[model samples]
Target: MTLKRYNMEKILKIITGLAGALFALIGLGWVIKPAAIAAEMGLPLLEGTALNTQIGDMGAFFFAGGVITLLGVLTGKRQWYYAAALLIGTAGVFRVLAFTVQGATLPIDKLIVEIVVLGILLASAKLTSVPQ
Candidate 1:
């Protein structure tokens, strides 16, 4: 059987969709066991602090966004995908900013990975054409 070549747009959409699903899984894991995540990341366990609360909220948002992104991908809804991509990309930027503002250095590896994912999503958003 011959392999079919994919255009950049299709590849980007697949990448973004997969990344969104992965993010959703991560978020679900965090929601289920925030303490486990904290321990794994060497962060303090949730003790009802403002920072922890913020983290929780962020996690929830990410989870919801991821779900929406996945649905958009499945439905082939260009607008939904674009909106989700923008929202998640903006959130990723804010996360990096938050890390910097806390007198902590940004984790380059994490930031880079997030940036790549966002880039793929953005490219996919632009590449997708609405069905007539």
Candidate 2:
């Protein structure tokens, strides 16, 4: 392999690893301290069943995405990356829908991060291949 290509791969791996780590930590926060994480996300954690759903559902969503992303990077499995991309990309689409149809404010910050992560996962999936 060329030196430049080798370096580029290294950089991409580093970026993807960081993203996975950050997401996992955020997921942990959701489970351990749902109130703070919910506040940060501009969400409420009301009492009773709603609070349970907020913590359980959101925690699983983020933790699964992070773990799958890490699996892709560690195992050199393109399918895992594709899975993460699909999950995150779908969330991005929802953000757009909320803004356009649900009368919610534009979530530019979250959208930007989602788009960048989606790009990274898709690119990584394309660049890597599974053994035949």
Candidate 3:
């Protein structure tokens, strides 16, 4: 059998880096046009000053998380990777909390998306610790 070599750390590094990039892009979208983005995500785009305020607040949160994740990607630190995972996992946790409080009114689709994101972030963080 021919020998095959796999540089797992290198592959995971790239994958996590790309994940950070995606988060940054998504944050930018929400920041620039939260209404349109939220609508596309199947959330109602509310109106009024409160709507703008809420969207801005949430957009800033996303932007901060995304930037931090990108920094983790650049630094190649295991702590940074876990930090990113924590950021994402918190989102999923909050979604579940909202679902519990709001009952069936909570959107099913968004819950699904949050779960997927949490899974990816957790998996990435776990893989980052693989022995070299």
How does each model score on TM-score? 0.73, 0.93, 0.73
Q: Report the number of backbone clashes for model 1.
A: 0
lDDT of 2 at 91: 96
Please report the candidate that would top TM-score against the real structure.
2
Q: Across residues 5-76, which tens digit of lDDT does each residue of candidate 2 receive?
A: 677667777798889888887889988998899899988877898888878788888888999899988988
Summarize candidate 1's per-residue lDDT along 1-132 as a digit string, tens digits: 123324665676687788778778767767787777657555676566765674677577668778877866776667767677677778668767788777666667766776776677666656666541
lDDT of each: 0.69, 0.87, 0.66
**Residue lDDT tens for model 3, 40-86:** 76767777987787677667666666776667656655566667677
Candidates 2 and 3, the one with greater lDDT: 2
Ranked by TM-score, the better of candidates 2 and 3 is 2
lDDT of candidate 1 vs native? Answer: 0.69
Clashing pairs in 1: none
Off by over 4 Å in 3: 1-6, 104-109, 123-132
Error of 2 at 52 (Å): 0.6
